[model samples]
Target: MAQDWQQLNEQVTALLKTAREQVLAKMQSPLTVDEKTNRKDLVTNVDKSNEQFLIEQIHQIDPAARVLGEEGFGDTLQDLDGRVWIVDPIDGTMNFVKQRDNFAMMIGIYQDGVGQLGYIYDVMQDVLYHGGPALGGVFAGERRLKAPANIALADGLIGASGPLVVHDISHMQAIVHASAGMRVYGSAGIELINIMLGKTLGYISYLKPWDIAAGKVLLEALGCQVTTIDGQPLNMLSSNLVLVATEKAQRDILQIEEDDVSL
Candidate 1:
């Protein structure tokens, strides 16, 4: 069967909205939480239920599509051979659990490794940032978003992982000193949203495919650069030290030495 991405995008958007409603209803109840890889890496029953719900809906909409979900509810995908849906049901699980305000839900649809549609839903804010190459423009809620200016690192704030700064990984400290300011947002989706809205010039972190897939699609569609610290292409199937930034900020940040050298 031939795929109509336009129609599929609309259907997926509606599905995501409905999923948001379902998740919000569940949030009013007490949550059952569990540890994943470490104490800081957490998952709740909401995460599992949401992933299951999303995978089920994806199967209904496109049964042949391969779904890769953060909660392990989907397939063990080896490659992006066909239609693939990468999902993070509850990004910022810790925020969802502790704060409940900074979390988001994200999905990225790809065809043969090419991004087709992307969505990042700020569950509490009711703001959905979505679109892709197929859609031609990204949007926040109903308003179409403009591409962020190609600003320099010294002129804009940078979002980073707190530990990255504490540990001084890849000269992150020097990069921070070069930026106008810094923010530590626990959620990757929210950090990406900040960059998309021009609130920050860039965001950097060690992120898995599900954590970055949707953001990569939306950011790149808006002419932002999404790549590794060393300017390498991101592998959608692997975890990476991802950097999402404006072109100028990316160039400036990449120029810094990887060692503990001052800026």
Candidate 2:
């Protein structure tokens, strides 16, 4: 049976609203925070509860679809061989626990490994960025987003992962110097939102599957490029130093990386 993407999108949108309400209500109280890997890497009660809610709702929407949720509440799959949904219940957990402003909830639906639909909800701002190839194009709320200008690396602000810049990995400092400036918003979804809105030329970060999945769908649908640092295609299952940028900026950054190795 063919999936009605439009109908599925509608259902997912409503589910996100309910998730948002739950998150906002939880913000009134203290969060139950725990360290995941380190003090820097944290998770909260909200993250787990939200993932459970989302995965349960998704199962109700399509019993055949499998979900890869960040909180380990969903199905375990060896491959994206069927209808699959990748979800991040709370992206930027540190920001959510500390500031509660810059975090987001994201979901990406794929079929046999092909991106079908994406939703990025900026929970605090009440903005939802959603859509994909099947739905025609990407949108923020109701406004259709146009392709961002093809700005080069030297001419535009570049978004960087703070740690990458601090460590000077991948010649990140040189990349920043070649750009007009740098911005690190601490959230891949939020940084991708900046890219989709044309507020920044590009962003470079090491991201997990859940972190980059939804933004990859939304940004690519808006005519932006998402790839590895060397301009390689992503496998969609492993963590990598991902680059999301306008075409021109992508070319410029890759060139810089190439030149750095020659020196």
Candidate 3:
């Protein structure tokens, strides 16, 4: 079983590596950008192509595997049971089509509701944050990572979305206000990378499964907590206000938002 799982990881990693290269090769291709909900929520043909490629690979490898891809090409998943592969073919699609520097490709594999593997590829930088709780996560190009200290909200830098900071959703302003300082990266993948590196104590935002899947595995392995804003378990199929923080930071964060905050 372990060997089979390892083989799956390698196969998925190969697909991700290929997807990364394909996006890089088409980085400056003709702009076929469009909006999802608003102009800010962008998607491109590259995102579609990448997701399609990955889904095909998963189907060929494990026909029973369900893929939750960012590009609306996966199953209408209401439950996250059985073997599921959550993928963000191109995170930071806005950055991908606009600046092309801050995007990422992410994949998270779960077996019967347990996180088995996670991979986040920073295409331009060529860094892959991969591994699992079973194997312990790794940066894939560096020495073994030390799990970040269990720090409070005020102990280290925090990451958040720019709009949330301004809008003060769920008292996000108050949460970061108690922190030493706040950093808004506008890209979930980049912000998550900061948390994994122990550069930030916490990162909170309204995130979807694919948006936070890979980060969830890597950060939790580094002794961080990834859950809802109120310290509730994450619903893999639903979008919620996601909180990624150390244990000490969790209490400080849950206090910032009001009671009954999940909408």
Candidate 4:
């Protein structure tokens, strides 16, 4: 399984590089863009094309795996009962279309509802954040990353989505008061990367499966803790306010739930 996995990783990395080239080439052309929830929630031609490309590659390797893609490009998933590949072909789609940076390609592979492998590719920077539960996480091409310290909340920086921070849901107002500082990156993949490299102490936001799937797995493998804001284990198919923190931070943050406001 290790050898097979190594080969698969190599293949997936190559594919991500190819997709990056395709994305850059397409950026020079006019975009076929549309909105889903509102005007700002955008999707572009590149998003659909990238999803198609990745799904094709996945089919070549594991045709039996059920694929859930962000662009409505795969199976209509109601449950995570089988082997599933939860994917976000372009995680920061708004940033991709507007800023041409900060977007990422992420995939979380699970077998029988248990996370196995997770990958997040920061395409523009050419950094692939990939790892498995059986193996430690990696950054750049060769550097082995160390797990973050399980720091207490008041002693560390908090990585939070801006809207959530402004609203103070889940007593995030109290959370904000307890943190050393606050940072928001608008991208789950990017935020996860910072947490993995010890740039931030924790990340919390309302996230979907494709949004937080690979990230949660990667963070957990790097000695970080991930759970719902109320301290329950994550349910893969639901959109919920998720928290990724070090062990000590999790303990401190979970206490805020007692006075948290429901959205």
lDDT of 1: 0.92
| Top candidate by lDDT | 1
Q: Estimate candidate 2's alpha-carbon lDDT, on a 0 to 1 scale.
A: 0.91
TM-score of each: 0.97, 0.97, 0.93, 0.94
Over 1-263, each residue of candidate 3 has an lDDT whose tens digit, in order, gives: 87887788778778877777778787767968889999899988888988998888888988998999888898888788899999898888888887878888888888888888888888888987788865655666455677888889888999998888888888877777789999977678888888778799988899999998888888888888999887898988879899999889987787656552332
The 0-to-1 C-alpha lDDT of every candidate, in the order given, reads: 0.92, 0.91, 0.83, 0.84
RMSD of each: 1.6, 1.5, 2.5, 2.0
TM-score winner, 1 or 3: 1
TM-score of 4: 0.94
lDDT of 2 by residue, 171-221 (tens): 899889988999999888899899999899999999888998899899899
| Candidate 1 stretches greater than 4 Å from native | 1-3, 258-260
Identify the superior model by TM-score, candidate 2 or candidate 3.
2
**Which residue pairs show collisions in model 3?**
none
Superior candidate under lDDT, 1 versus 4: 1
Candidate 1 lDDT, tens digit per residue, 1-263? 22487788789889989999999899899999899999999999999999999999999999899999998999998899989999999999999999978999999999899987899999999999999988889999889999999999999999999999999889898999999999998999999999999999999999999999999999999999999888899999989999999999998888885444664
How accurate locally is residue 67 in candidate 2, as Cα lDDT from 0 to 100?
A: 95
Question: What lDDT does candidate 3 reach at residue 140?
Answer: 62
Which parts of model 3 have CA positions greater than 4 angstroms off?
A: 258-263
